[model samples]
Target chain A: MLAHAIFFYIFSLIAIVSAIMVTVSKNTVHSVFFLILDFISISCLFIMIGAEFLGMIMLIIYVGAVAVLFLFVVMMLNVAQQKNQWFSARESSKHIPVGLIISTIIFFELIIVIGGWKYKPDLVSSMSLNIDSSISNTHAIGYVLYTDYIHIFQLSGMILLVAMIGAIVLTFRQRSGVKRQSYFSQISRERSDGVELIDVPSNKGVKSDD
Target chain B: MEYLSIIFSETYKILFLLVPVLVSVAMIVWLDRRIWAFVQKRQGPNVVGPFGLLQSLADALKYMFKEVIIPSSSNKVIFILAPIVTMTLALISWAVIPFSATQVLADINVGILYLFAVSSLGVYGIIMGGWASNSKYPFLGAIRSAAQMVSYEVSIGVIIINVLLCVGSLNLNDIVMAQESLWFVIPLFPMFVIFFISALAETNRPPFDLPEAEAELVAGYQTEYSGMMYAMFWLGEYANILLMCAMGSVLFLGGWLSPIDLFPFNVIPGAIWLILKILLLFILFALVKAIVPRYRYDQLMRLGWKIFLPLSLTWVVLTASFLFYFNLLPIN
Candidate 1:
């Protein structure tokens, strides 16, 4: 238990530090790397807390796919060296109070949730699913996800599908006057499509349009 | 004191797993080259050490002594970290791999997910290496590799879902054990083929190796690396290849199980069968490298997104429905 506590402290410390570094790093690429480090440390903490499935999925989804895309965009736009001076930019001042208020609200909401958990333990336990100790972490989660939370789980999936379709509809466009390779047409062309046989052309040495 | 001893024992076991893997990495490089040479009708590395078996070893030594020339304009930290990251991530995924019924480094419950996670993160190394070099070719190579890996990873994930559906467990050992009666290769043949190709794309092996294509990008993301650093990339690439082969064996080829249930075949240790399967897959990988031409970038993208994605997704639906209909899912 002591060792677990020590390791948790270490991972959380790294996560916090890297989370800060993600915002503070001047280079966009470095920021993305720091964000990845943050995700990794958080996932490690999740694994340490016996949520191995969630932890691995977090790493796969965030570090593997999303973070790579982040790096891809940051690298492609050649914005790695761009200085992040949010406060100094004159136009940015317009959004500062709004950002602060939103963040403050989120922070307060989290505090309230924690406070409620401590003060009203029964209330917190009311919604919690029964975790079977005999089953593995993955099996337990599967039971809960597929049974108790199936509707909400499927609703989230539907939301994601809608978002994806909306994104595609927003961005997809067709351009005219572009010569594109039609794979079907290219592959299906036969000898009959382009060849002609003439009988009397042999005597006149195949004269042009005669 | 007990904790200290436990840590030491864990380290010992880790060395046991890792040393063999690293050594095999070297041996497989030689094997890959020899296969390529044989396919082209030539003797490969015959003069080195009994059929040039020591060639890769010698190459490693040479790389050790050579100068690691980091480019002046490159991001030194990331440039160096990239190869280490690549090599480590490639090796780390092996922790969950079961050599036999009882032999594994870490028997985590979500073993397949851990492997999937680690393999997916492999792109970071190449992307970091490519971007940190701050050169046109390397940067372009990194971009190409990033897109290629991401695209194929989608299909790979769905295809893995098919296998998972059949096995009904994410545990690598359990997945292998589920194949006691019949190997998944017999039933999930199409998914296996798609997976094999995606594994090629995932590892950036030839035909799908647009990221480091020599003719166009001049070694691509590896353009700026030199000496041991370059060797690190090669080591990581080969290790990743081995990981894919291991995954293929685990998911489809029944892992360490003997092909025949009879006495003679079952007498051999499970690890040997596992290694033989990996070697067979590796040989196919090498054969493809020797036989097939490199894919164009657009065509490769089309293959991954248009063809493999739909095909694998449909296979997942079919597999799930069939399993549901036949009551064939393994109960973990």
Candidate 2:
């Protein structure tokens, strides 16, 4: 129990510190890195709660893809020297009140939530409600999602498909005065006359007067 | 009390081998350089030790003595933690690996899951390292690595499921022991080859190492890392290679089981045989790196999705049919 609590505290400290740093860091790149660290420590907290699949997904998607994309955009934006200072100062000031209010609400909510719930780790473990160790966590999640939550899963897939099609349609463009290769052209390429080896004199290739 | 002491004593005894094996994994850099040198008709690293066995040690000392540098624009917190995450996850995967019948650190039933989990976490370190570097090349490398890893990981998982079907257990020891009758390589040769190649691609070894292609990305994700931190990445990479090769041995080869059991002279211990097989695989990996040219990124992705994935999926079905026809599987 003590061991679990100690690790929980450590992970929470990492999560909070990095979360704070994400806002406090002057550089956009540094703020993104702090955000990545914050997500990772949150994943650690998920693992502590025995949600390994969710934790792995958090690490893989949030830190791996989304954060990398954020870094890419930040690096490629080509922030001008004078713009950087102005940008940093304006960005930090813009969100101060909003962030403070939201954080305060979340902090109080945590306290209220903990106070309202009766703590019973043993009962939760025995009931197999919070902890399900019969099989790999992925298996249980898959079963539930495919069976009980099938409609929701299918709806989400449909939503994603619509979004993907909409994105392609929005981006589609036709350029003038350019010939595009046909897919059939690639498949129907003939080798006999299309390619040939010819012997040529090396000196005739190029000659320099000097 | 006596039983607990016995377990502790056995664990300590195994540590003697595990510690050295882990350390020697760092020596792979020396081996990589020397092997490539020989391939190119040059003598390599004859200075540090007899035949330069201690070159890696000397390099480690050099990295240790050098000053650590942090860029003023870099993310201080993540920049410091990145290499530690990389090295720790790289080293921890060895715990569940079975070197021999009695030489495992943790022979848990979920050993395969533990391995996949650890290796999957490896991408986090790479992503964080590049993100924290606050440089162009590293950022691009990190994005490329993220996409590459996520894409290949799905195929690797499916391929591993094929192996699990054959062995019917996730424990590394059990998987190896099941091969005692005949090597899984004999029956699942295609899977063995595909898995080996995919392992190379997953580790981002040469040819598939687009993330760290020097001519392009300028050291890739580790562009900002220097001194001991850079050395840590080197050690972590070599350790990952060792782990992957060790995994290949246990999954396909007879692992610790000697190939020639009919003969009376079984001189080598199972762990030694395991080590020998992994060395051979490692050499093969290096050889491929030396000979093969790097594939274009699009070509690499096309091969993974269009070629390896379909072939592996076919193999799974083929194996399933064979097993079903032979009454080898529990249908219920």
Candidate 3:
């Protein structure tokens, strides 16, 4: 228990620091890298808490796919050269105080909620699906996911499918000048399509379509 | 005291496993070169040592002594961190990989998913390296890699679902154990092929190595990296290839199980069989690299999204239905 506590604190610290770095970094690429570090530490915290499945999933989804996408866009836009200015500009500085006030309020609200929330004594018993110690975390999730939460699972799949289609539809374009290989034309060409075996009267007199 | 003891023991086991892995990485590099040479009918690194067995070690030493050049425009911190992340992730994924029934580092419940997740995360190293270089070619390479890895990962995920459906468990040991009756390659042959191809693409191996297409990209993401930093990327790449081979063996090739349950074959330990299987798969990987032509970027994307994605998704549905209808789904 002590070891677990130590690991949790360590990971959470790393997570918090990296999270801050993600926003505060001057370079966009560096910010993305920090964001990845933030995700990794958070996932480490999750894994330390015995939610290994969720931790790995988080790593795979956020750090692997989403963060790479973020890096891609950042590099493509070449925003790393842009100097980060939070409140230096005269006009932009005016909104800094307001932003800080709102952020502080939100932060306090979150803290208050976390401090006030408590688990009921009977909460464990009242749960519909208790984690079975006999099975693995993945198995437990699958059991609940396919059974009681089947409809929600299917709905999420639908949502993903919709998102995929929407993305394709949004960025897809047909450019006029681009030449593409037509496999059908290439594959379906007959022997006589181009080969006209004519008896050349003489090398000089055999004129082609040139 | 108890926790300390556990940590110490775990560290020892990790060290034990890692030593062999590092040694094997060196050997595999040498072997890959020799095999490629054989395929091309040329002498490989025969002058270094007998059969050039010590070539990898010599190369490692050379890299260590060479100067690491950090480009003036590059993000120094990220440029360094990228290779470390790549190498670390490559080695860490081995934790959940069961060598045999009991020869694993961390035999967690969600072992397969853990492997999947770790393998998927490998793209970050390439993207970071590319972006950190702050060069045109490296950035282009990184973008290409990002899209390529992301596209193939979807299909790989779907293909794994097919195996999971049959096994009804994500545990690596259970998945391998379930293959006791018959290897998944027989039943899930198409999925196996798709998974292997996806694995190749995921690792940026031949026919799918558009990210580092030398003719255009000029060394791709590693354009700015030098010395040990460049070598680290190579190490990570080979480690990933080995991991993919191990995954292929574990998921479809019956892992540590011998080909036949004959007296002589069964005498060998399961770990040996697993190693043999991994070596076989590695050979296949090398052969594919030697033979297959590099894919066009558009064709690669088309294969992943248009072909593999639909194919693997359909296989998942078909596999589930078949398992359900036949009452063959393993009742976990």
Which candidate comes out best when scored by TM-score?
1
Cα lDDT of model 2 by residue, A154-200, tens digit: 99999999998999999999889988656468888889647665666
Model 2: lDDT equals 0.79
DockQ, every prediction: 0.90, 0.20, 0.74
lDDT of 3 by residue, A1-210 (tens): 787788889889988998898878677777887898899899898888778888989988897788878877877775744443534556776777998999999999998766655535465477777778887677788889989999999999999999999999999999999888887799999999978998867656776788
Q: Which lDDT tens digits does candidate 3 get at residues B227-330?
A: 99999999999999999999999999999888999999998999899889999988988888888899989889999999999998988889989988999878
The candidate scoring highest on lDDT is 1
Q: What interface RMSD do all candidates show, one decimal each?
A: 0.6, 4.2, 1.2
Q: Is candidate 1 or candidate 2 better by lDDT?
A: 1
Q: List per-model TM-scores for chain B.
A: 0.98, 0.93, 0.98
Candidates 2 and 3, the one with greater DockQ: 3
Ranking by DockQ: 1, 3, 2
Off by over 4 Å in 3: A80-116, A119-125, A128-133, A199-210
- Model 1's DockQ? 0.90
Task: Name the docking class for model 1.
Answer: high
Candidate ranking under TM-score, highest first, comes to 1, 3, 2
Q: Kindly list the per-residue Cα lDDT of model 2 for residues B1-332, writing each as its tens digit.
A: 77679769878866775688667775777888888788888898879989998988888999999989988998788888889988888888888878678878777665776677677667767777887787888878877776677667666767877887787666789788888888988888888888888888878898789988899999999998899999888788888888889888988887888888866526677888888899899999888888899978987887788888999888889888888899896222
- Model 1 spans with C-alpha error above 4 angstroms: A80-88, A196-210
